[model samples]
Target: MTEKSMLVVSAHSADFVWRAGGAIALHKKNGYRVKVVCLSFGERGESAKLWRKGPDMTIEKVKAARREEALAAAENLGAECEFFDLGDYPLRVSDEALLRLVDVYRDVQPAFVLSHSQKDPYNFDHPLAMHVAQEARIIAQAEGHNPGQKIVGAPPVYAFEPHQTEQCEWIPNTFLDITEVWDVKRRAIECMAGQEHLWEYYTRVAQQRGVQAKRNIGITVKRDIQYAEGYMRLTPAVVGDLS
Candidate 1:
């Protein structure tokens, strides 16, 4: 049988680490081949600390640092990562870039896809990333987009948690219990040195999500969930049974 795979489309280098790190680590532990596509290094907008490192900080330098951090995080989570090098702080995805993402969809043939929320008032780039991710999925399923290449199936799409769930209007319909891989996720989260301030915040988010996940699973399940990742599933779940 073919190995299962999952794809994560991130607007910035560290987005994947903060939002879906638990999912990445847990799914990898479950034998899924994980792939992360970072649309940009978030040099201008997200790298505030790197910029404060004196007057000699350049965009290239910041980007390099972000790249290293993202790579380390992906490595810790056992996932392969690809960088688009597209500048952030108003991420622009050209027709060429969109097609490139389509190619990734065909190549990975992901069992499911993860990306940002559809709406983020604080970060416009976040919504744009999700827009492109869904657009690419549609194009990848089109036989005429790249004739003769294998087309991808109808893989479910999920929007990972945003920083401000209420503001972004993102509600989690799916919760993944990531207690077993919480340590691995934390290790990956630590790799993001530039965003140290958010480390504890996301950790708390995981703990809160875990409580919600446990409540949803009921008290009779007898499973202890200490950490979890929330996702707003964008597509319908086609299941054989409703159990």
Candidate 2:
């Protein structure tokens, strides 16, 4: 039997760590192969703390630091990470880069794809990443893209939680109970020292989502959910039964 895998397309190095760390860790524990593709190191935009370290902080240095942090985080979550180093703060994806992502789609043939919300007013890069991820998946499904290559199936695409869901118009229709893997996710979050300010914020987000998840399931379920990650599934799920 082929190994099941999941893909995560991140706008920046720390995006997957912050938004989908719990999902990654939980899936990894469940024996799924996790692959993370970071479009950029977020050196210019997301690495503000590094940039504030005087004039000695160069772009190369910042990129290296971000890459190291992302690597550590991925390791903690048992994921394999690939960096595009495409640059950020106005991330531009060339046709070549898009095709490269399509190759990943074909190779991994992920069971599901995780990315940013379709609309994020605060950060244009976030939405663009999701756009690219969806586009690549479509291309990978087209047999003409690469004649003999195996075509990927229609894997469900999910938008992980955004920083500000209200402004982004992102609603969580799926909640993953990540209580068992929360510790692994927390360790991964700590690996992102460059964005220390958001550590506690995401923790609270998990806690809030956990409460919401518990409420949604009603009182009949005996499972106690203490930590959760929310996702907005962008694709249709075929089911045999509604309940």
Per-residue alpha-carbon lDDT of model 1 for 111-206, expressed as tens digits?
999999999999999999999999999999998986999999999999999999999999999999999999999999999999999999999999
lDDT of 1 at 178: 95
Q: Rate the local accuracy (lDDT) of all candidates.
A: 0.96, 0.96
Residue-level lDDT of model 2, residues 81-190, one tens digit each, is: 99998999899999999999999999999999999999998899999999999999999999898899999999999999999999999999999999999999999999
- Cα lDDT for residue 189, candidate 2: 97
- Window of ten residues with lowest summed lDDT in model 2: 84-93
In model 2, how large is the Cα lDDT of residue 49? 95
Q: Which pairs of residues have clashing backbones in candidate 1?
A: none
